[model samples]
Target: MSSSEPDRAVPDPRRWKALALLCVAMFVVNLDAQIVLLAIPSIEQDLGFTSGSEQWVLSAYLLTFGGLLMLGGRMADLLGRRRMFFIGTTMFLLASVLCGLAWTGEVLIAARTLQGASAAVMAPTALSILVTTFDEGSERNKALGIWSGIAGFGATAALLVGGPINDLLGWEWIFFLNVPIALILLGLGPVLLRESRGERRNAFDIAGAITVTLALVLLVYAVVEAPDAGWLSAQTLGLIAASIVVFAIFAWVETRSAAPLVPLRIFRNGTLVGGNIVMLLLGMIGFGMGLLVSLYAQQVLGYSALIFGLGMAVMTVMTVFGSAVGQALVTRVGFKPVAAGAMTLLGIGCLLLSRISPDGSYLGDILIPLLVFGPGLGGCYVAATIASQTGVAADEAGLASGINSAGFQIGGALGVAICSTVAASVTGAATGTVAINDGFRAAFIACVVFAVLGLAVALLLRANRPAASPAAPAAEDVPAPRTGAPVHAQAGE
Candidate 1:
């Protein structure tokens, strides 16, 4: 067998089953994030949640999920990916059930937090499994394309489905829907998924994990609160300052720790760093657009939830299509152009969206951008994900996947906070339809800026052919000192 090939022969039936289960899991987790957006109004009405507290339902989940992702990946490595996967799936199912049964906003928020944490554990491990199960090259690309597609497409699909489901059934059913899917995946997991673990000797970096988690949580909290508290508020300043301190400590800990939770050396590679930068930017632009667009559709356009969902459906379909196409072409053309082109398209789409006015129609104004933006985002996602994991070793795949996923989740939180702040600031003192359009335009312009930045980062990636196998290290890798400095050591130095 080739070096990149799996040691064991392909278990055809089992592999297909495993892929199906993983896809279902991906769909459920993503659906949870977006479905709630459409149902938020209903949830508030039913649970009597205050306006300020309602955002926590989504924020709490994102906070815990994003905060613990590195740790979850580390746990998967130490404990075993399959074990962690099963545990995560079970926890997610239980949390979904609790969310469905939640009577108060507090309980729903808590359940969502649990759901997010469990999702963090599951998401990275799923990618790791795909890497291990499929041989590198076409097979792996196809699997990853599907995986990435599910994550993006699921969110948009949730919006489409959530409105109808909530209207026909109830807000509870939005979560209850996960129960059946989770059960199916749980049943298939043991039989289809093989047992896998990372390098056994590396110790888990508990201190590094804790510090990083605290840093991200504090940072996200500060940003999220800035809109309500004002930028100059002491509470916001204190949280932001504390986050900076914690992150500095995290960097220090990673450098010295024998088994760093995040190996600082990984960032030294231009490809990895550049890829993650683009991913972060793409996340900010893409997610921010989704939030603002949804708000505009309902608030300004005066569209029903169902109509709003339908209007966004084109973006979802195109995203899936683009992912499929990008996966097929990435090996042939390489990641640089694909990423750069995608960002360019995304920038154009956002600029077009910025042109929207009170007289704009869904088909003419929204649909055009959705079409362009979906494909652009899909290309960026595939290229960035592949680039991040390109040279990662088998044992380190889980950690690499975790870091990439973290960039995306953190980007969403950051984007939402920043975009919301900008929109609020622009529209705060204004009134009526003009104010709404101004807020939307401000957010879209921000998206355009983010997209352009992503394109610039993508251009920094070297024009090199992608490797045929996971075993082949990315061209970006170079031998260096443990301190991440380029050096040549003597035998006895």
Candidate 2:
């Protein structure tokens, strides 16, 4: 009998309970990320944050979240996912308290950074737990499908709730709300979730982690600052140069290290590389759309936070529908076609969004495109996730999952920075709503370009098939040698 078969045959109510717990945790994480958008005006009013500082409120969280995700994933494998999950949840809950109590812009930004780091650890480990618990079949697919669906819906739901919460209670309530949810999850997680550990003993690559994190931070800073500071400014040029050097060092270290943070060999697999590329594009497009559309709704269309949230809620409902359809199609039609088709639809949606004007109504200007883009992005997210892990060895699953999560997190930071820079440059301190609308139109055009690129990359992905590996003995096979003892002491190898 297959090793997984034994686990599958066991009637474990804990598995279903675990899935529910994780899904709620995921909803809270995603909600926090988007809920801030509705409360941005309130925050600015209370904290006196300038437009430039406002951007940092979002970017700081993203920077830390994206930069630390790979490290977080490796830590989960080394320490134990459930252990890491608890630790991360505790940190996140504490951070939320700090954010709610923050009196200054600096304090809020710092708190946001901590919140993002906690999210990085929690997000991937939740998915990893799901994968480890469920056998690869209908059950696994269904679990993942619900997970993906919640992710798709959570952003919009945040916007929907954010406005009312901020309006009725205060902006602080948005952060305060997470405390109860996290406490509940923390209470239940230990009892319901099973512990799993990676089989390989690898040393954590501290140097690689430092170099890569620095490189990404510098690169993103350069991209985001280039529009404000001239592209040829000394600061921008220096940061860009430093980024290249750091990345080169990271590559060299990974190749030579006995235990690398990110195994260089993983990229040699076509599916893994392709999936990461697709995920990057998906993040660039999907996140870019959210940032631009929210701005358009409030700044251009003269909508209140409440109305803007309502519009976003419409999009979230559609995204849930899209995830359902994508899950149904993946089994019968395969991943490649679904991904490619989704990208095409996403591009078409972006093209339509580019036509919005200052006078445009939500129904005419936003609703249709959001309906189309919702499903397209939803399908792409699932396909890229599945593709990333399709053939990964059990020992490398944590690392693979980390890279996948990092791709989206990093891509989001890059996308928001790039799109914001472009829009800011085009708008240029314009006071009129019409000028802001024009800037949003330009941003939408940029989103269309990204969607086209994503479509091209999606087409390059091969159809899903059984993976062949010399290292893969069989589903029931045990490791030839025990590596767990080494892993406990030296992580990220």
Candidate 3:
């Protein structure tokens, strides 16, 4: 029997319970990414963070989260998904408490960094567990759809709850909010989750792991600092070069290692490759646009943080709606069409947003574009996720999940940097509101380009499509490994 056959034949009765637990884990991860934004003002005031240093509140989290994800994912595959999940959740719980108790800016930044590292471990491992638990067909699609919707809620929840929490309680509550969620995960994890790991290897690729992680850390750090330091500044260029050199070394190390941290061969899976590429673009467009919109609504249009968040609630609702529709469409038609259509919508939305005036109202300027963009955001995320994991071996699921998550995280950092740089370049020496509006317009145009590029790449999924089979492949049905990657399909090829 194939390794995966038994899983199909005797599905776990607790799969749904496990899924619910895993979704909570994802919600926490996604929530942290945005929740801090709303609380930044309060955190700065209480912690005495200077204007320049305040950004570390967000940067510290993104840096650790993006840098360590690959290592965390690999650890999940080797150490045990359940074990990693438990460990990560424990760390996250502790970090949250530390953040809430922090007396200074430095302490809070340090705690946020730890929180990001723990999330890196939890995000991919939880996803790997979900992928393994559900059969890769309609059932899996449905699970992913729900997962996407919850993730949307988590992202929006920051806006929905963050303002009130900051106003009523304090910035500390933002971190404290995670305490209950993490405790629940830790308490219920053993009862709901099963232990699983990848194939045993004689030697762990310690060198490869270290080098790749260093490379990613450098890359994320460079991008996060680029907007302020100047893209071509000596520091930014030096860091970028260092990252490239380390990555090259990692590639060389992978080629020579018997049991590589990430098998070079895994990149042969075309669907995984294409899906990650699209995911990167989605992250870039989504995050870049989000930052610009916040600036436009609050800085230019004179809206309160709480009110702006409430206005954005519609976008969140539409994102959930889009995720469900995308899931259903992918199950019937295929991921390519669904993905392409999503990018098209995003492009249109960006085009609309680019035309926003300095005196624009939320209803006239923002809500209309968001109405079109939210579904696209929801659909693209779901489709790319399903596409990325379509035909992976059960053992490597953790690795795949990590790679997918990393793409989005890193892409978001890059997108923000690029968009901010563009905006700054256009707004140089201009103190006028109209000049700032011009910068925002340029940033939206950049997002439009990202969407267009995503559309182009989504089309390539058709080249080596994997035929959909009703059942998991048997031992005899498993095909020989191919030199090139396959564009795996969940529906008819």
Give the number of the best model, judged by lDDT: 3
Native RMSD of candidate 2 (Å): 4.3
Evaluated with TM-score, which candidate comes out highest?
Answer: 3
RMSD of each: 7.0, 4.3, 5.8
* TM-score of decoy 1: 0.91
Worst 10 residues of 3 by lDDT: 484-493
**What is the lDDT, from 0 to 100, of the residue 41 in candidate 1?**
89
Residue 244, model 1, lDDT: 96
lDDT of each: 0.79, 0.77, 0.85
Q: Any runs in candidate 2 off by more than 4 Å, and if so which?
A: 1-13, 200-202, 230-232, 429-431, 465-493
Q: After superposition, how far is residue 159 of candidate 1 from its true place, in Å?
A: 1.8
In model 1, which runs have C-alpha deviations exceeding 4 angstroms?
Answer: 1-13, 470-493
Q: Candidate 1 at 387: error in angstroms?
A: 0.7
lDDT of 1 by residue, 317-404 (tens): 9888888877777777888998998899899998999988876679877889998988887878888887887766666667777777
- Scored by lDDT, model 1 comes in at 0.79
What candidate 3 gets wrong by more than 4 Å, as runs, is 1-7, 463-493
Of 1 and 2, the candidate ahead on lDDT is 1
Question: Which lDDT tens digits does candidate 2 get at residues 1-493?
Answer: 5443444355346778889888887788777766887788899999999776887677777777777778787777766777788898999999999999999999999999999889888887777766666656556666766777787677558777888888889999999999999999888887888666575455677898788778877877776566667677898899999999998999999999887877788888898888788888888887888889888888888888878777777678877887788777766666678778888888889889989988899999999998888888778877777777666665556667778888887777667767887788788887798888888888888988888888788788887632322222112123423532111111121
Write candidate 3's Cα lDDT for 18-43 as tens digits.
Answer: 88999999998988887788788888
